[model samples]
Target: MASVAEAYVFLTYLKVLFLTVTTYLTCTAHNSPTRPMFSVFTSYNDSLEKTHGLPTNLSWSQLASTVGEDKTSSSCQPVGIYSIQRHGSRYPEQRIITTYQTFFSRIARSRINEEFAYLKNEPLDRFTVEKAECLTDKGYNELLEISARYPARLFPLFRDPVSIFTQSSFQSTETNRTKESAEAFISGLCKECRFITPKHDEDKLILVMKDGKIYSEIHWLPILHDPLLLPKISSGICKDSIAIEEHSREFYSFKNSPFVEEVLHHVISRLDYTGDFSMTLDELQSLYEICATEMNLFGASNWCKLFSQSDLRAMEYLYDLQEYWYSSYGYRINYLPYCVLLQDIASHLESSVASGSTSTKKIFKFAHSTTIQGLFALLGLYRTSVIPTADNYPLDGNWEYRGGIISPYAANIVFSVFRCAGRSTLPNAIGDVKVLITHNEQPLKIGPCDSYYCDLTTLTSYLRSKVGSCDLDEICGGVVRDLPMKT
Candidate 1:
């Protein structure tokens, strides 16, 4: 046998030779006339502008269109606004980071193919997975911009600077991200304003359940049951296991398709390496997640270049399906907590109307996307007529209606209540007050309401009718005898 140093030098030479040959083959194959050049680099910047699940960057014009032009409504004066907002972009969860690191380490140790040899030697310093659940700088800035722009957009409605009260979901252990988002929003609204971090006792605006105990800070007791309510009458409804399995199978089929595999192989083959190449489907998915999450956090990622727009759409659909089945309208229990939250909103609105305080003009809530999605589903916003199944995701389907679009980072829903001077057009008028609802800064019409503004009496009555007494204990804990799989 040769001495250790000689053996090391020989092995290094062999590795270099293998990489050179592999790189040459990859380049040749990619340059073939029959093969279309697939590169994300050319479109990466454009693609970032249209990423589905993360918050889409909006221009002032787009924001203006969403809130509508300040068409002078002589009869109505904005008295108060209630806004529910999702937290800004954040670092991947610890679990996601751990999975990504494991995949990267495996790639580093394995034999890399010619098409993916670049990955073997790629520096991971920029992609270092953060272990904490904190908001990225991008996330912070998104919130900052939103806060600064909102006052300007609503200027016509509320001419004077209004006092804002910011609140967030209360946890036994503090959620720093939610708090930080709330702080950023307050800072943007007015620099001198202080953020109110409500504890369980002071959080009367939103209901909180901890260890089977429900707490509410509000004193007004509205009727608890509303006919138009979103939560199931019974808790017997669970996710359809058959449907979930079918979805899984469909996802697997897509992931294992020749097109996807070719893309994966191309990515892996470019990684410079000396060993035999091998990668599992899970590892491939982890790589995609890294691309997606990194892009959302940092505005760009090289991993994004590994796939085309079609590939991104497929991945987006998969994530949408997951949220639909597990979080939004999927299971009966999935939206119960949000029901309580809705009740809280209604209670606060009613209280504001009763108190008639211009000093407390805005109610701002900061929460996770889970809260936003749950509330959206409960309100039937952007719901598909036919529930999406894993096997039947149509490429031509309405992408705008997807949950990814509805509850992206910094996603928000706003209800602006106005005190009007005219007689109500709506049935059972309670004075001349009206309410306008907006989602992601855009006005959203309630079912058959037709106009951007719904009569305050009509809106509150509808909400109260659906919400009834707004009792959390009864609604959350009540047992419905027989809940069907689908409403």
Candidate 2:
């Protein structure tokens, strides 16, 4: 009923307000490309409605043609390769909590809660969140669907009716996540999946040598429980948590402890080994001899001065101390106990795989975002030293609030699909196993691997800069791989 002049004036004022406020704020973080991510209802576009275009492959008939892959008109042949991949995007539902504890422990507890929220909503997904690694409920469904959609890309072991397959879980010996992820995966697999627990003491594959041996490995797994125990850090710690919890003890000490690695790090840090040069055995030993007295006199606080005197690799020593010093000392100071029985569970898994048939058994490891990034040297993913514990809750529900095109935290599921490839070596033909990442994201404003999922467009942009072009397929590395090529 309004006049045309009045309507134009009203629309003009609204447009002015939108441009000056909401639109500007919302669009600040977006990097819209020429094409939008998804398209809908394009069959009649070209003939009836002309402005927009459809994806090149869109057609009802072609879509139908591709539907029956798992249902072929032909007989199946044996192709028994197994490959591993992490789970797709998920988010640990974040929550605010309240508690008072040491920083690290507190962090662990809160992060568990965020993950707990995820499980609460998505209970059917397998994976328990207690320990260091495991999948979530959404991750459980996502992987099952991923395999179903891309069965051709999946290892042959996963698709076989006779094959025993399930995901590997990563649990830090905590509580909820481990049990939950395993349950989710088991429900989906509907087959008994073997569990591979990590060792209590894990050795880092720091370098692969010219002799083709995997060595120079510094361990990340040993300090907690039995000397040789390697708890499947993931494998979703069992529902019998109470059974192994006593074994899952952590140690602490205000006084200096006798862990030799702690002493060595202290002395080396004091001397400042940048890692440009190696230390002699006697020098290493003598330094350890002096470390106890020095640490006893000064707490973990001043232990670095010992390396202040070393000009050799001063920077490198500082770097090592920067990275490993706190952990080493924290381990010694805490005298934490590890879950030996839990570790046995991990070993049991390795043994199970060793004993299974090369052609028949398949192992799938489902674990956390950090477990994969930390181990793989993914220079891209972000991790924090602060573990989020239950105590981090703000008094108000409005803690750390943000809006207007905010990017969310994405959780990943990493799979290490293990297949028994040989008979004589205890299923030891290991080099053939593969790894891949699957994500449903574009680029992030913060950048690649910004969220748990690798931001493909950022990686693509980075690679394009290095290669002097933007064609993603032409080079070896982009921000993210477009499609995993089978080697």
Best by lDDT: 1
What are the C-alpha RMSDs, in order, of all predicted structures?
11.7, 23.9
lDDT of 2 by residue, 93-205 (tens): 22100011121232233323231223223222211223112333444554454334333333343454224232222222222342343334333443223323322333321
**Every candidate's lDDT:** 0.54, 0.27
Supply every candidate's count of residue pairs whose N, Cα or C atoms clash at under 3 angstroms: 27, 94
What TM-score does each of the candidates earn? Answer: 0.68, 0.28
Q: How close is candidate 2 to the true structure, as a TM-score?
A: 0.28
Per-residue lDDT of 22 in model 2: 28
Over 79-165, each residue of candidate 1 has an lDDT whose tens digit, in order, gives 667787777766666666667778778877776555554666656654455534677676777778777766555554333333232
lDDT of 1 at 248: 49
Candidate 1 — worst ten consecutive residues by lDDT sum? 35-44
Cα deviation of 149 in candidate 2 (Å)?
Answer: 4.0
RMSD in angstroms between candidate 1 and the native structure over all alpha carbons: 11.7
